[model samples]
Target chain A: MFCFIALLVFSVLGIFSATHRKFAKEAFDCVFRRITFRPCNTGFREKVRGIILVKLMKRSSFFAKVFNKYFELIAWIFFVLMIVSTFYVGRGAYNFYLYGNCNGVNEEGFCLFDPTGENNKISPVAPTCGLDTPTVDDLSLANTDLDKFFFIDNNSEDTVVFIGCYVCDFTRKAFPDIEKLLEKKKPNFYFGHLPVKHGSDFISSYDYCAREDTSGDYWKFVELMFTSDIENINDQNYLQEVVDKAGYDKSKIDECLADPETLASIEQNIFNIGNTNIYGTPLVFVNNKAIVGPKPYRVYKGFLK
Target chain B: MNIKKLRKDFYFLQKKNYIYFDNACNSLRPDCVVEKINEYYKEYPVCAGRSNYALAEKLTTDLLGVRKNIAKFISAKEDEIIFTKNTTESINLLANSLDLKEGDIVLTTDKEHNSNLIPWIKLKSKGVIHKTINSNPDNTFNIERLSKVLCPEVKLLALGMSSNLDGVSIPAKEIIDLAHKNGSLVLLDAAQSAISEKIDVKYLDVDFLAFSGHKILGPSGTGVLFGKKDLLEKLGSFLVGGSTVHSSSYDDFELADIPERFEAGLQNFSGILGLGEAIKYLEKIGLKNIQKQKLVLNEYLSNELLKIDKLHIIGPEEASRRSGIVSFYIDDIDSHQLSIMLDRSAGIMTRSGQHCVHSWFKSREVASSLRVSMSFYNTLDEVKKFVDELNNIIKILR
Candidate 1:
């Protein structure tokens, strides 16, 4: 058991040091013999034990005595700990690959791979909206009506519901990958703009009116809104220019923006998005699973049927 | 002797600050010995006794000078000293060269080092009989037992002058006399005893003696085998090469003189020069002083070690009998483990295991033992630290 632990530790240390390599080779031999049901040559174990006890004895003889007495039991404990830690490390790495966060999908915590939690970051919904921030457990796509939202029905069984705001940084970060996913998978995709950032509510209303147009240029308008400068996104003139650039009729969009029903419809869209218990922009549901931030493209594509 | 001043001569004692107790294995060389070795390589690093060039002639003169010094150290003629690799090789050379035919017997003590034991044991393949003379229960040489084994059929009485395992020396003079009386020639393995004890070959009247250079504060890979000039001339050359022969044809060769004939091939010039310097250094300090210093340190160590419970010393209880060595084993703790602990905790180097006398250990049914062999340069303070460290190890390990 001690040889097993020594093998793992010395093997890792052997990479950077030549002295440890000799011990690592000894430990490997000891382990190989032990697994074959032959008695382990006690030299390696005794040498390592003597070194440890000698070091310990200098600081405290009592501790050294205790350590020497329970050396086998301590080795067993360390072996079990090594196994458990290895399992958790393996699981963390797997989760980091699949979910973009070691803690799991839509969850945020410190990750060794992504130390700043950048993949799981989001532009939170303003407290001025009079809604409590939702926990990861509360985030769900259930009870959210998708019929009234702007969507592309591809007659595919896969459903992707993405809720974003044009002015939100995290949402803007996720836009290109989402566009790529929509183009490739062609799922029954829905786009819901909730306007989480300040001064971006009117763009949602403009988006609603543009989708109502027969030009089929709503996605282009949404892409322009996300990619454009944040300061210019809220300006009406810039918005109109973007609207024109996306090939939407200026007069028809302006008329739709002026209508009272457009405001009511945009408000209804926000209510529908809130029903998913979202507290941030760029909350995407790939079928039943909800991903909350700007995850890597593979993570979003991994959900496709 | 001023041990403090003597310790200054060894660079390792100053730099490593280790309580080096493994002197029986290899003593630390003084700066003089190291400089002598360097001098050979720096000045005349050429083949001795082979070439006619000035450098080669100078080297040949220097090598012969070393042979003379070594011979004088053991009270033998210059031609009687044959240079080999080590004590093992020296003994092997004699074992292979001796004119012992089939049914001839070789008798050795039970506590002989493998260097002495294995060479004689190997002679059995040539139809020579090898027999062991059991030592006393206290691991001392039994003269009575040796007398019983000695006879005309016993061609050689090969024995270690001192047991490296226990540091107990045989009464070489009495043993040699007894063996001669029974028509058996004696060969002494003096690897352990030659360092401190005075070995007067003329006084002891020993037929042959072997010792390693490294054990006597000299360079490794150097050893000397001293035999009577007539006896050396009578023995066949063990290894034949350039120096071993004066001239050779396709199928015939004229063997060189006694020492050169036994030396074979190119010798370790630097090591031989260093060994010569080591002998001079030993003479300056005097072997009697060295023996006295070692006994004082060993007596202190033995008395302190005896105070510990379940720790049994390997040889005689008297420290004087054990020379400079204190070999012991705890009841349950592994000697290797204890030795390692002592080294790690205090830089106290020691030897553990059978000390290459496997037959003795096997016969005693002992797993292993730790040996602390002291040298003249070692101080009383170093022995105290060793004892303290050993106690600490035993307290924790046991």
Candidate 2:
């Protein structure tokens, strides 16, 4: 929905290689030091030239007073700006805290105060306020006008899972067309490389289900896609289409699929939220506002001021 | 060594107004190298190996001639030399091709450039154990320290001919002999030292040597990998493509002979021709005389820098161990900031940061430093002017 073409600027040209915490600090430090260190440090003759000229003019006291006043004024200006900038950053962070959604999934595929179940009835779990994830029973009302089945990624913090494989069949990349597009849409996602532990079987693949899921707050999206098709698509419609086409045989995959591994992974993902001061999904923050995938250059430009 | 011509080249550099201290990074292509490339591009630019046409044959012959020239230059056979993109690729080729089994320990120094270090350490994930020998605080090699680290598990000892961070030339002859006595093959990264100094691989008895032509007044995108004939024969090719294979089918393939097997796809023909010209130029000037000039200029710079207060040189004071590079830094100012100031204000170029020897800098516990390197073309006047510039920059910085 965002400017897809314009965001390509960041995907292709931006310095993605520089992302680690240490390097990030070093980058800021490098910029700060560079700006602070230039200009006046030109030449020794240039250095003494002004001072000697001032002294020879018999206005050394006036020159010294001017220099002191100039420095003091500049110092106050930078200090005030820095304080304002810090408070602005603090406010943005406060908003992130207030708006963050770290609750259990609902039928709407979002964490709401009260969520609904398949029969349009209230959820059985009477969730507590702020303490536990809210259920459908706790709902004040339903906003049916909002797009149903739409993924409301209104939550600012999104997590991405990065998967890297060496001998991977990089062939099937274009097949997961929908997932690929989604991955492209939101660059601010996580896909922790599992090192190809999963095999092409239900059990082996589901083993990832049991693997410890860290947090529910961040967007648990996987950017890495492959062309391994589990279902035969005569019409070639992926996900629900593949299941819909399977008909009676869909039971083996869709209905009977209470995959222990998946449940385990959800448990794992949900288990450690807010534990060990774990900062949920990485924020691919551009100019402070949260954006996923490559937001159009205009989205980035809009926030600059 | 014809100081007048060298000065002319230096003036040619000054006319462009690029102080170009990135000599350690990669030296600028000399006029002769540029002409050699022009001759290849203008006269005979054709794809090699597949064709027996006149131009193709000339390209093939010229490329092979470069191989032979490089082999002769380093006392290697033409068949034992494999051309690659740069020093990193050359060492990576060696790393991938070498018969490294699990449990084989790679003995190397902490001061090694990443090009020599990464490829070997990468083998660690494949279950190969890597053991590092410590470099002295002054970036000098200690024979006893290396001897203690060399064990039966040490199948190979990789070394850099000169430390890129500090420009200290290793006692490779002695190091190679020590490794051989322990029954280990040695690979030397001569990317930094090869152009500035004489390299007699046979005399030094090095099992393998890799170098970049760009560092030696040649064009970029050309590197040479040389190994002992027997060792080269034993190693397998990592990359498989058009020229590298002898025979191929849908399912199976046979690799080509030694050097061809290693060199896959289209060759950088122009780069090699230019590299050959660079070698021809160096030979004309003579490595001994070139080495002498660089050392004189280096020593002058190092001595002058020593005169400045708070300016600490990174390497040893001993002239014999150090090459033409001098890495130094001062109090308060970061090396990155200093390098920028030097380039922007004085038009004096220099390299700063870790110099791709993070482990070396980390091991020494010194943060980061600025580097000013010299080649045969650099002179006493440049050194003096550099000192004057430093004095000015430092005064303002302080």
Candidate 3:
């Protein structure tokens, strides 16, 4: 009984080093008292011997004497089982803590995200163990044709959508440069925009680029838009100057711009880009895998594959 | 409910210096429980039910009385409850005994501790399909998602009554009612909930329940599994030998009635006896008072811990939603490494890791977290010291 209590104390408080060392000292003291009678009245071994004598005495005196001779060995077995079982239970608990399973086999594996079981059905790309999820869903504007908006080699077999705002200088320079380099290497390379901007200016810009530009000179039109004076972007007639310079029919461009569906499409594009879960501009994805913001040409070359 | 007074009963909590905040793992046992175990070994060391002696008869009667007390504690009949080694074994026994065949689905929450998750998951090899409904990001059970998965194919829904990761109680009664309407049985893993919250199995009409005694101030290697009486009769015994049967012939045998058929062989009689005393100790303190005191400590800890920078508390930020647990993570420091520092610096013992819910962590890509689980014996002073030490440790580690 005392051994059982000692095991319990050893299990609970022994997680701390100080308490563990104190228990070690107490255990040594207990063992010392069991072997030597110094500073002890009666030890656990003596009590077990007394109990064995009382039970054996009821049968025969000769058997009682014989059993009493090996009582210390019996006490050792009892104490060992108590200590071992306590540790066995502790080990089982530790296993349960680390692996959730008693055997510590984590074979059922982990669901990458959304243990709601909608992970696979939601997106095929969300389960990449070490990769960032390219989470463009059905609501994304990337599914729209680049030719319907601003075309930059829309006939290419491989396409990459670069989500950025023309107000940024990095997008003004990097978009065309990457498109030129990749287009020369593979004739079927396309760079498209799912445009984002800081304010309502994106609506007019997308309306001009998507609806007004019809001669396949949309790339030249966007280039003229980004390089022009920053304050003239919102002016309707000044925008017509940039649009006419890119060789668009001015009356046709105005008629195309009058449709509310053009502005609604741009608004939907901004909303779709916002829903992509990307925080920064100039974020590009080759197929569905995201490339970090505005990398060097050599780095983009590795990602183009 | 008075922490300072209740602290005196526990050998570990009586220490003025050490702070034990891992009660969700294993609670500190009271002196009465230890004394009861010692009394059992000293007075009647003989085995129960297999002997004709006076001590053996006394042992059998005392064991039965302990079962009766446990049944009363959980609002169950003595015949409906069966004792096992721990909650894991209890769940495993139910998983093995229940009549689940091929194409039969068992539903569980994604936030379940491994004890509840692994048992049902292991049944996939036996043609039982295991499906997990997504828990809310805060580790609370999402009833809407539970409703989505409670289809006709679902034979049983095993879930933790409260999350071990975050101490939020699941809406067990509502889930049971919904599952019953779907024609599915419900198994509540009350390992964390049974101690901190009230569990009236009868009122909830829970078909099955499993809980570990060690998590509720009782002895380790002690657990209880409760089932409806008719359901218990329908399920076969997972373990069969010795006391499981009342009579046997050469090739055939009749298993004993409800509870005895499940408790095979010689049981943990000493631990069960100690558990009976632990229940008595809890009842004396009033479980409602214990629950209320834990909430007070949790509210204090939550308010203070929220003030610290770089400390992110898991689960709902509101105190009303959480119970006696607060699992959080600090920036830059790994959870296991930080826990070692806490133990060495201030004698603060906390659990740090996935907390047996690796799937939950994996879903969020969160590797580990530091959990501080409280009990009724914890004090405001202790909580303050823990928070203060945590602030200091973050400073040094950062």
Candidate 4:
């Protein structure tokens, strides 16, 4: 009880010290008395202590005895704790005021140093792919038939292969950008459905839809799976609805789902993707240089140029 | 509890048909909370403190009324409650405002979330001492160790009321009593426990309490810091400027009273209004009922999860002790990969990672784990679906 009162009294005096020069001495005295296990000199602290003591006596003699025994010690501890917590809070607020995040980490956002840091904003400075050697022609696409993959456009000179799985949210969100890239540049963009078979069984259903949509309405199927809160993508009827919505020929989709060739092609894409050291989704390889996951439009423009 | 009726209140559950197990991260707002936020923008969009117009007066009254409701929720006076952007800021307010200097110490548990842990840990740079007591053998709070650490020298015990990682609730009342007895002030981080549990600050004799609104079906960027009025007044303002001062000259200024002294500039009026509505909704349901329902859901999830081979559940094995959360990791499968599989296969939303308690994870010698944290709106059917998906994921991935 003395501890709570001391903390309260010290706080008021501490605040008042800013305006009233005399209040600093009172604040110091309050803290000193509270810390050293001395009897609180102020009537406010004494009254609070007396009230708590009476309440303890009313409850039980044993309780009152225990309260009296630890009263000073408790007050000291409470006073010190309150003081430390106040400083700690002040420091954090200072950091937040200057750095945006409580800590100096710019990843959480709104940092004074980097205002656009949290958004993963595009850097105006041109970024290199950081590969030691340039190797676009070295990537063996001569043996592989491009038509077997979910080809968005096959006419452009520059090839931009988007290695992604439909089940992944990042990959699904990245499609609009990939679509824009294809429409603008007309790059030989192969929407490779690299269904990472090790992590998920549901990827197979997505792979099935990818293979079935030969007319390249595969993106429509991906959009349906991405947008709609469907539980099982592997459900044949549910996937068939996606295929129908994508405007794919019904019998062709069924034939593709049943075909061994479709599975072989998907396996080949995954195998190729794995060889490229692509462990995650929505990887765009523009002329064998990789740009991973939802980069801003300027990044693509930079690479395309 | 009438889950079917309660489920109707949450649009994401009813219309979207999502099995939301990510309540620990952020809860889906109910219709009333959304409506309250909308009302704030549509009805009175003016700043509460800066204006004296009729709409501004109404807005200010509504905001103040919300403040009263928040205080009532925690059994504190309105003046004691200070609004913050989130629990992180609330804790930071206490961290900055207090006059802790060299030789002072702040002791916390190993299982605290980053919000509670980081603020205190940062004080090490200022020459203030910071210490941590490890959890018990079963990963519960170690009372004996806490007692050993609690000396006259130790100033503060900053602890989470409940662990966000594995959902083990520490004995907060016992800890508070012990801290007061041993001369340490207590700060309870009620971020995870506030929504599901009943927390009366007066009953607990807690010196300080902080919690976020988003985890309680309210708007994002909303939080509360409850402090004893006297202690709050003592706290020096860290982020000052704007409406914090009453009157000012070129060099000198008088700060505002109690809560406003801490609140600084214009607040999140919309979010605060929404939080009030959210609290009203929770009160109608009763927090006791919410806690009871959570335990039932958690128990079913734990029992079903235990049957799976190669899967290890973290913290206490007892379902009741785990609160509304069940965190587990399989022997070889990556938790992030599993999270994706669960989402794609079952539409089950689960959080997977260090859970911002990286220190605890580092101590436990685990890399990552998947967590299914439920709220009252969750059903037995959802639990069954989650388990079935888990079983299927194990069968296929393994």
Candidate 5:
């Protein structure tokens, strides 16, 4: 009972000491000092100390749990954020849908009624095709958008070919010849050619494709014009290694690389035969649209109307 | 508790959608702000200066008015406030303006955001010595300990009004008064406190206060520096540009007067106009009322969160004295995973990791923490929902 009484007496005295500066300067200093400053760190002590220790200690489950705890906190925050954001977006969408999206385009073209907005009454974009496929009629239909490209075969009965620098070697060789033949067969053949290289003294054959975005890299195409090891360019394994390291998927694109003969023929046609708009070697163009040397003739040829 | 108003006010941010909780980082733009920007571009669109046209004059006047508004917000003379890009710029301006001798010491705390810490750290590296005081692991400010460290050499006592990490309020006024008694200058980083705290530079006798605009519902790329007129006049201007020159010759040039001298070049004009609007909006609501609502939310979150097992809140438990920030951690989750999961699954947003208060977190024996900060715009349903999500996350995340 005396001990309890003594404790109460000390507590009162302690409170007094804490309040009065003259009586308890040192005590105040101690509390004040305690309120400020974290203790010093050793050389090994870090702000994010023990973060890697879990991995170093091979405590996978422990690390996962620890990691998850922080993420869980983030999750709650995200949930709140998403709830707000979705509402915001949906409201905006709803307002636009109901009030009519007048931010330049008519309401009929937007995906307001269609999935991914693909079935709108407005212009449709041509579907991206594999390297060898030539479908000009599909590419330039009223169903597809042509304004964004350099060339359009809209309402034309011809096929469209997309020209790429890296496809098949055989197709590259035979493309130029086919392009000239196609142009002869149909004087009004329409095609699209991408100047992957901005400018490197090429002869112009005819009308070029309409442009969307302006060229930002003038030196990029010409930079690859002369190659020290052309074989390495076609090596799928070497390319795959690069793509893999860069985190790109190569497994899904086996067919594009498998047809080397087609690639070679296309290469030969472009560099050797049809309207040689490019200097004295591998050149390819469908009537008016063309690029010089080893370009994807199949794509360009497919675009003839 | 008022979901109706919150949902309407923040109608721009409703859910299954990503709600960004990182207001301290950058608040999501309100539609009022977005439309203001659009109106500026589509309607009264004109460059501020460099033209004698009516739009130009209006833009110029609007720009200068924002500087005046910033001064009133922090309780300073119009000429004392200089528009800056953000808090880092304001602190940098102060750091550069000061004369740092080889032996002079700058006193600061471990709770400093790197914006406040690095300028002095760099000064220390350049021969000016620095002394650091610390908060207890929980991050509270104590004045007596600071007085002990204020030797004759200590020239500046740099501090934050409220810590960015845990939102623990520092006794900024008391600390400033104490530092002045020691014949040291005090600089308050009001980045975390400005929106919530009612600052009276005259009552507190603080020499300088700095804050970012975005944290207060204003636009980014804009900030305010509030310095006493006398000190601003006494200090050297760090940025010298076309706008800051009073007169110039081939070899010699006269500098512009105080605030103009400090505000060197082209400013964020539209941002300033937006900041003025935000200030007016806050004024109509009143800081005290906002503080009250934020306090209730902070208390609700802290008390409810503490009941969960294995949870460690990083700072003070009381709601009245602290800023509306709660940083806590569960036993074993890597913070980034939770941040990502929070984004993908829960649709919530919170700041994770050390929050740039590296020294404080280290001293407190914390690896990393998750911070949930509240603004007046936030609703209690969001808080309850946050706590509920947190509970489920802690369960499965473990």
Candidate 6:
């Protein structure tokens, strides 16, 4: 049992040290003999036990005596600990590979693979929005009304709902990757605008008005919004210029933006987006699986199949 | 002798704060011996008898001088000294070269080291008989038992001059005289005894004697086999190679002189030079002084060790009888564990186990014992620290 633990420890240490390599070889031999149901004739266990006892005997004889008496029990305990820790480490590696975070999807807990929680980072929603703090388990798209949102139906069963703020930095950072994934996968994609930053709510309303007009290419207009300068998006004249440049009727968009029904529709859209329990922008639901933050393009594409 | 000043001569003693008590295993080489060995590698490093260049001639002269010096050290003729790898090889050479027929007996004491015991045991394949003379109850040599075993069929009496297990030396002169009276030759295994006991081969009239260089502050892989001139002439060469012969034809060859005929091929020049320097160093220190110093240290160590309960000494009760060694074991504690702990905790080195006399321990039904064999350079202070550390270990282990 002690040889088993020695093999694990010394094999790892053997990589960087020549001295430990000898001990590692001895331990491997001992372990091989034990697994084959033969007695450990190498004396490796006794050698290691004697070394430990000698070191312990230097400090206290009573401790050495106790240690010598219960060495097998102690080795068993350490062996169990080694096995348990190895299992957890293996599980963590598996979760990291699948979810891009060691703690699982949308979890904000510290992960060794992503030490700064960079994969789970988000732009926080303003407190004035009157929303509860979001939990990963609570952020599900089951109760959300998808019909109210602007969506592109590729006639495929797969769907991706991307919620982002036009002015948020993280949302802007995620825009290119998500845009590339959408073009490549061609899923039934939906875009929801949540203005988490100050002075960004008006642009969401404008976006809603522009998308409601059937004569305009809304996706081109939304792409222009994400790619354009923040100052250009914030300028009302520049927004109209972008709207006209994309070949939409500026008067029709303006008339729709002033209508009370448009306001009611935008509020309904916000209520529907809130059903997904989103507390931050750049949250995307791919096939009803909610992922927070701007993950790499591969992570967003992983859910397509 | 100034023990402190003598300790300074040894390089290992100066480099570390260690209590070395394993002198019976191998004594630490002094600076002069190391320098002498280095001189061979640095100056004239070539074959002695074969090469005729200036450097080789000088090396031949230097090697011959070393042989002469070593011969003087043991009071034997220069031509009688044969160089070997160690005492084991030296004894094996005698065992193989001696003219022994089937049914002839080789007698040895019960406590002979494996080096001396195994060679005789190996002769059983050639139909040569091997016998043992039992020791006294306290592990001392029994002269009465030897008289009974000294029969007409006993061709040789092979014995250890001193036992490495407990440091007990036998009555070599009396045994040799008794064996000679019964028409048997005597061979002494002086691997342990040569360090402290003075050996005058001519005076003792011993037929053969063997000792290793490493036991006497000399370099390892060097040993000497000394025999009477006529006796060495009667023995055949065990190993024959380039230098063992003067000239050879297709069918027959003539062997070289006594020492060169026995020392086949190229020899360990550095080891031989270093051993010569060691002999010179020992001559200056005097074997009597070394023995006296060892007795003082061993007596103190034995008395201190005996104070502990359940601790039993291996040899006779008197420290004088055991030379410089104090071999002891506690009933419950393992000697190897104690030896390791002593070294780790206190920087004290000791020998644990059978000390290569496994047959003796097996006969006595004892597992092992911790042996502390001191040298002249060992101080009383070091022995005191060893005792203190040992007591600490015993207390903790118990």
Better of 2 and 4 by DockQ: 2
DockQ of 2: 0.01
Candidate 4 matches the true fold with a TM-score of 0.57
In the range B1-398, model 4's lDDT, one tens digit per residue, is: 79999888888887765788999999889999999999989988899977889999999899999999999998999999999999999999899877888889999998889998899889988888989999987789999899888888788899988888989999999999999998788999999999988889999999999999999998999999999988887888988888788889998999988788788778899999999999999899999898999899999989888888878889888989988999999887667656765665557889888899989887878878999999999998999998887776555444
Give per-model TM-scores.
Answer: 0.87, 0.60, 0.57, 0.57, 0.57, 0.82
lDDT of 5 by residue, B1-398 (tens): 34356445454576446555676676655556556656666766787756799988988887778777767777778888888898999999999888778889998887889999999988866689877896665568766678778888888988888888877778777788788888888899988888878887878898888888888878888898888888888888799987788889999989988787888887777787878877776676688877888788889988998898787888777766566788888777655545545554456788778898888777767777888887777767888877876665556554
Q: Compute DockQ for each candidate against the true complex.
A: 0.67, 0.01, 0.00, 0.01, 0.06, 0.38
Native-to-model Cα distance after best TM-score fit, residue A228 in candidate 3, in Å? 99
Candidate 4 clash figure, as a count:
14
Report how far off residue B30 is in candidate 4 (Å): 0.2
User: What would the per-residue lDDT of candidate 3 be over residues A266-293, giving only the tens digit for each residue?
Assistant: 6665544545555445655555555434
Categorize the docking of model 3.
Answer: incorrect
Candidate 6 per-residue C-alpha lDDT over B217-274 given as tens digits, one digit per residue, 9 for 90 to 100: 9999999999999999999889998789989999999999897899987899999999
Regions more than 4 Å wrong, model 2: A1-305, B7-14
**Candidate 4 chain A — worst ten consecutive residues by lDDT sum?**
A119-128
- lDDT of candidate model 4 versus the reference: 0.76
Off by over 4 Å in 5: A1-305, B1-3, B14-19, B47-51
Please report, in order, the local distance difference test score of every candidate based on alpha carbons.
Answer: 0.89, 0.63, 0.73, 0.76, 0.61, 0.89
Q: Looking at model 2 chain A, report the run of 10 residues with the lowest lDDT sum.
A: A141-150
Candidate 2 vs 5: which has more TM-score: 2
- The candidate with the higher lDDT, 1 or 5, is 1
Model 4 stretches astray by more than 4 angstroms: A1-305
Candidate 5 lDDT by residue in tens digits, A193-282: 322222211211111100111222211222232221446534534544433433333443333344354345333333332222222222
B379, model 2: CA deviation in Å?
Answer: 1.6
Q: Candidate 1's error at B282, in angstroms?
A: 1.1
Error of 6 at A43 (Å): 6.6
